[model samples]
Target: MLVAAAVCPCPPLLVPEVAAGAAPELDAARTACSDALSVLAAARPDRLVVIGPAEKAGRGTYPAGTPGSFRGFGADLSVRLGRADGDVVAERELPPSLAVGAWLLERVGWSHAPVEGLGVGESLAPERCVEAGREIGVRPGRIALLVMGDASACRTLKAPGYLDERAAPFDAAAGRALGAADIAALEALDAELARELKAAGRAPWQVLAGAAGNAGLSGTLLYEDAPYGVGYVVAAWS
Candidate 1:
């Protein structure tokens, strides 16, 4: 079962090199993410699974040593999910969401457990997401999750998806559900509405709810903001 979870937004801007001169804009979120990961580490889980949005559902897993780069975002920096130990494993590039997750793990020097990555499609059905989460939860040992995705991209006129009246409310509800560990609320999130509002976190958060499996974990909302008009949330459940 999921002993702990950290909910974070997946944005290339989270990487200072990608943000460049505007790096300070996300400093607080970075700090909050570090704090959230600390909680996950304290849980002492046997395994750590990073979940994020992808183009397809049930995509293959990314090994711990998978590489991620921000070169596409104009940064020449590269990161690996875990430190390279000179193993000859096949190399694969992580998706943007998992890349951010990997960056967070590196930021914290995560070493408490073996780590892996799962990519959930944005359009995946709720039941399918839950089912996938259940499978992960039933793995051989204790599991923790680092869920990455943005809430909404329509918070302001200049936002990536442009402004929408529904964006604020959608993000507000999502933030509340995450902060309270309200699994039902997360599971009940309307996929149609989420898609309309450009909320990428909907599917990933639902998966987290499924993995939690009525564990009744208490939560703490560390940070909630729309720095670039994309709703970014940081929360921890333990």
Candidate 2:
């Protein structure tokens, strides 16, 4: 009897003082994320494993985590976190994150990866959300998975429309006009990612659309009303 999930929003780039002028929109995102985190904290997992690189780690010793590593979220609920520190996860045995990464690599190409202190790294495994649940010994009916990444990791603050990298609704026509390749890259990445997550054993899977690289596109948000950014929440029994 465990079913709760939330899809948090992803602004273009969140700064240290996220609350200075990030009211309303950021509040909504926080509320959404807090609800999901509460469910996660209540899961009572042996560990909370996150497959992400260290945000402020160095190029040599890494920040503070390793791939397939473990960490303590708190006394109520713990998690096993995974990070590469200064390097990328081994392309093959990156555990539950490889397949989705492969799909993105095949389409978006590595040139678009947000490395170091920039965009969302190739840390999220389409199946890692499942892997996390299973690793913590959470029963099939009591698990929560969160998949987060930079909504628009391709464009620049110096770009035409998104001059400040602020998260906003993307106009479809303007997006499509930017370039088909970029749009295809993100779409392909997200589509395959969603499918992979669904197949990873998270029934009732839900994908919260995201927007991070739409300024370079050539279309307007018409039917797909997915907005400028996307967030996905995957939850199911172990």
**TM-score to native of every candidate shown:** 0.96, 0.32
Candidate 2 residue-wise lDDT, 2-103, digit = tens: 232222223321211322444444443443444444444544433222222223221112121222211121112111123233655432122223212222
**Minimal lDDT window, size 10, model 1:** 83-92
lDDT for each of the candidates?
A: 0.90, 0.27
Q: Assess candidate 1 and give its TM-score to the true structure.
A: 0.96
**Local error of candidate 2 at residue 20 (angstroms):** 1.6
Best-performing candidate as measured by lDDT: 1
> Each candidate: how many clashes?
0, 40
Local accuracy of candidate 1 as per-residue lDDT tens digits, 53-95: 9876565588778888889999998887765456637456888
What's the TM for model 2? 0.32
| Candidate 2 residue runs with Cα over 4 Å from true position | 1-16, 53-120, 123-146, 152-238
Task: Look at candidate 1 and give me any clashing residue pairs.
Answer: none
- Give the per-residue Cα lDDT of candidate 1 at 156: 98
